[model samples]
Target: MALLGGIKEVPANQNSVEADELARFAVNEHNKKENALLEFSKVVKVKEQVVSGTMYHITLEASDGGQKKVYEAKIWVKFAWVLMS
Candidate 1:
Protein backbone atom coordinates (compact mmCIF):
# COMPACT_ATOMS: atom_id res chain seq x y z
CA MET A 1 0.00 0.00 0.00
CA ALA A 2 1.08 3.53 -0.71
CA LEU A 3 1.45 6.21 1.92
CA LEU A 4 -1.70 8.23 1.46
CA GLY A 5 -2.42 11.62 2.99
CA GLY A 6 0.09 12.46 5.66
CA ILE A 7 -0.55 11.90 9.33
CA LYS A 8 -2.42 14.98 10.48
CA GLU A 9 -1.73 14.61 14.14
CA VAL A 10 0.07 12.45 16.61
CA PRO A 11 -2.48 10.98 18.97
CA ALA A 12 -2.18 11.73 22.66
CA ASN A 13 -2.24 8.05 23.65
CA GLN A 14 0.41 6.48 21.44
CA ASN A 15 2.07 7.14 18.13
CA SER A 16 1.03 5.55 14.85
CA VAL A 17 3.12 2.67 13.52
CA GLU A 18 4.43 4.90 10.78
CA ALA A 19 5.39 7.55 13.27
CA ASP A 20 7.01 4.99 15.53
CA GLU A 21 9.15 3.65 12.72
CA LEU A 22 10.07 7.10 11.56
CA ALA A 23 10.88 8.07 15.12
CA ARG A 24 13.24 5.14 15.37
CA PHE A 25 14.91 6.20 12.18
CA ALA A 26 15.25 9.73 13.44
CA VAL A 27 16.67 8.52 16.72
CA ASN A 28 19.24 6.43 14.96
CA GLU A 29 20.18 9.32 12.72
CA HIS A 30 19.90 12.23 15.14
CA ASN A 31 19.64 11.00 18.74
CA LYS A 32 23.17 11.93 19.69
CA LYS A 33 22.41 15.58 20.33
CA GLU A 34 22.78 16.45 24.00
CA ASN A 35 20.05 17.70 26.30
CA ALA A 36 17.22 17.13 23.83
CA LEU A 37 15.00 14.50 22.25
CA LEU A 38 13.51 14.67 18.77
CA GLU A 39 10.18 13.20 17.78
CA PHE A 40 8.10 12.89 14.63
CA SER A 41 4.92 14.85 15.10
CA LYS A 42 3.08 14.79 11.77
CA VAL A 43 3.37 14.23 8.05
CA VAL A 44 1.93 16.49 5.35
CA LYS A 45 1.97 16.58 1.61
CA VAL A 46 3.21 19.44 -0.54
CA LYS A 47 0.53 18.71 -3.16
CA GLU A 48 -2.92 17.17 -3.35
CA GLN A 49 -2.26 13.62 -4.37
CA VAL A 50 0.26 11.72 -2.24
CA VAL A 51 1.41 9.45 -5.04
CA SER A 52 4.44 7.37 -5.74
CA GLY A 53 6.75 10.28 -6.42
CA THR A 54 5.29 12.94 -4.21
CA MET A 55 7.14 14.95 -1.64
CA TYR A 56 5.92 14.90 1.94
CA HIS A 57 6.20 17.48 4.66
CA ILE A 58 7.31 16.18 8.03
CA THR A 59 6.58 17.96 11.28
CA LEU A 60 8.88 17.29 14.17
CA GLU A 61 9.09 18.23 17.80
CA ALA A 62 12.12 18.67 19.98
CA SER A 63 11.88 18.58 23.73
CA ASP A 64 14.46 19.81 26.18
CA GLY A 65 14.17 20.46 29.88
CA GLY A 66 10.39 20.11 29.84
CA GLN A 67 9.92 22.57 26.99
CA LYS A 68 9.06 21.61 23.42
CA LYS A 69 10.01 23.10 20.08
CA VAL A 70 8.73 22.28 16.62
CA TYR A 71 10.11 22.05 13.12
CA GLU A 72 9.05 21.24 9.58
CA ALA A 73 10.87 18.77 7.38
CA LYS A 74 10.39 17.40 3.87
CA ILE A 75 11.10 14.17 2.07
CA TRP A 76 10.32 12.51 -1.25
CA VAL A 77 8.85 9.02 -1.26
CA LYS A 78 8.86 6.42 -3.99
CA PHE A 79 6.16 4.00 -2.93
CA ALA A 80 6.33 1.88 -6.02
CA TRP A 81 10.03 1.34 -5.59
CA VAL A 82 9.65 0.55 -1.91
CA LEU A 83 6.80 -1.86 -2.53
CA MET A 84 8.71 -3.62 -5.24
CA SER A 85 11.72 -4.24 -3.06
Candidate 2:
Protein backbone atom coordinates (compact mmCIF):
# COMPACT_ATOMS: atom_id res chain seq x y z
CA MET A 1 0.00 0.00 0.00
CA ALA A 2 1.22 3.47 -0.83
CA LEU A 3 0.98 6.41 1.54
CA LEU A 4 -1.15 9.42 0.55
CA GLY A 5 1.74 11.85 0.45
CA GLY A 6 4.26 9.40 -0.92
CA ILE A 7 4.78 9.20 -4.64
CA LYS A 8 3.65 6.05 -6.39
CA GLU A 9 4.41 4.84 -9.88
CA VAL A 10 1.59 4.95 -12.39
CA PRO A 11 1.47 2.55 -15.32
CA ALA A 12 1.56 4.53 -18.53
CA ASN A 13 2.07 3.79 -22.20
CA GLN A 14 3.53 6.01 -24.87
CA ASN A 15 0.71 5.12 -27.26
CA SER A 16 -2.08 5.46 -24.78
CA VAL A 17 -4.76 8.13 -25.18
CA GLU A 18 -4.65 9.16 -21.54
CA ALA A 19 -0.90 9.40 -21.70
CA ASP A 20 -1.04 11.49 -24.83
CA GLU A 21 -3.59 13.84 -23.34
CA LEU A 22 -1.52 14.40 -20.25
CA ALA A 23 1.58 14.93 -22.35
CA ARG A 24 -0.23 17.41 -24.50
CA PHE A 25 -1.50 19.28 -21.48
CA ALA A 26 2.00 19.51 -20.07
CA VAL A 27 3.45 20.76 -23.32
CA ASN A 28 0.63 23.25 -23.84
CA GLU A 29 1.02 24.64 -20.35
CA HIS A 30 4.76 24.97 -20.82
CA ASN A 31 4.30 26.74 -24.12
CA LYS A 32 1.88 29.15 -22.56
CA LYS A 33 4.15 30.04 -19.65
CA GLU A 34 7.58 29.89 -21.27
CA ASN A 35 6.52 30.88 -24.79
CA ALA A 36 7.96 27.66 -26.15
CA LEU A 37 7.02 25.84 -29.32
CA LEU A 38 7.26 22.25 -28.24
CA GLU A 39 5.17 19.56 -29.85
CA PHE A 40 3.94 16.72 -27.71
CA SER A 41 5.22 13.30 -28.73
CA LYS A 42 4.39 10.88 -25.96
CA VAL A 43 4.58 10.12 -22.30
CA VAL A 44 7.57 8.20 -20.96
CA LYS A 45 6.55 7.71 -17.34
CA VAL A 46 4.09 8.83 -14.72
CA LYS A 47 3.83 9.07 -10.96
CA GLU A 48 1.45 10.59 -8.46
CA GLN A 49 1.35 11.83 -4.88
CA VAL A 50 -1.89 12.44 -3.04
CA VAL A 51 -2.31 15.41 -0.75
CA SER A 52 -5.53 17.39 -0.31
CA GLY A 53 -5.83 16.55 -3.97
CA THR A 54 -3.39 14.80 -6.31
CA MET A 55 -0.08 15.88 -7.72
CA TYR A 56 0.98 14.20 -10.95
CA HIS A 57 4.57 13.80 -11.93
CA ILE A 58 4.69 13.18 -15.64
CA THR A 59 7.67 12.42 -17.79
CA LEU A 60 7.02 13.08 -21.43
CA GLU A 61 8.73 13.47 -24.78
CA ALA A 62 8.27 16.42 -27.07
CA SER A 63 9.79 17.90 -30.22
CA ASP A 64 11.23 21.34 -30.41
CA GLY A 65 11.47 21.86 -34.19
CA GLY A 66 13.58 18.74 -34.73
CA GLN A 67 14.71 16.39 -32.01
CA LYS A 68 12.51 14.88 -29.35
CA LYS A 69 13.51 15.65 -25.80
CA VAL A 70 12.26 14.38 -22.50
CA TYR A 71 10.59 16.83 -20.15
CA GLU A 72 9.08 16.44 -16.73
CA ALA A 73 6.04 18.28 -15.49
CA LYS A 74 4.29 18.39 -12.15
CA ILE A 75 0.54 18.99 -12.38
CA TRP A 76 -1.60 19.47 -9.32
CA VAL A 77 -5.31 18.72 -9.56
CA LYS A 78 -7.76 19.87 -6.99
CA PHE A 79 -11.40 18.97 -7.16
CA ALA A 80 -14.14 21.29 -6.00
CA TRP A 81 -17.09 20.19 -3.98
CA VAL A 82 -20.53 20.99 -5.30
CA LEU A 83 -23.33 21.88 -2.92
CA MET A 84 -26.68 20.39 -3.85
CA SER A 85 -29.75 21.90 -2.40
lDDT of each: 0.48, 0.82
- TM-score per model over all chains: 0.40, 0.83
Instruction: Report the CA-based lDDT of candidate 2 relative to the real structure.
Output: 0.82
Residues 17-85, model 1: lDDT tens digits: 555455445544565654345654443322223555644444556554456666555545576653553
Best by TM-score: 2
Worst 10 residues of 2 by lDDT: 11-20
Give the true-structure RMSD of model 2. 2.5
Q: Which prediction has the highest lDDT against the true structure?
A: 2
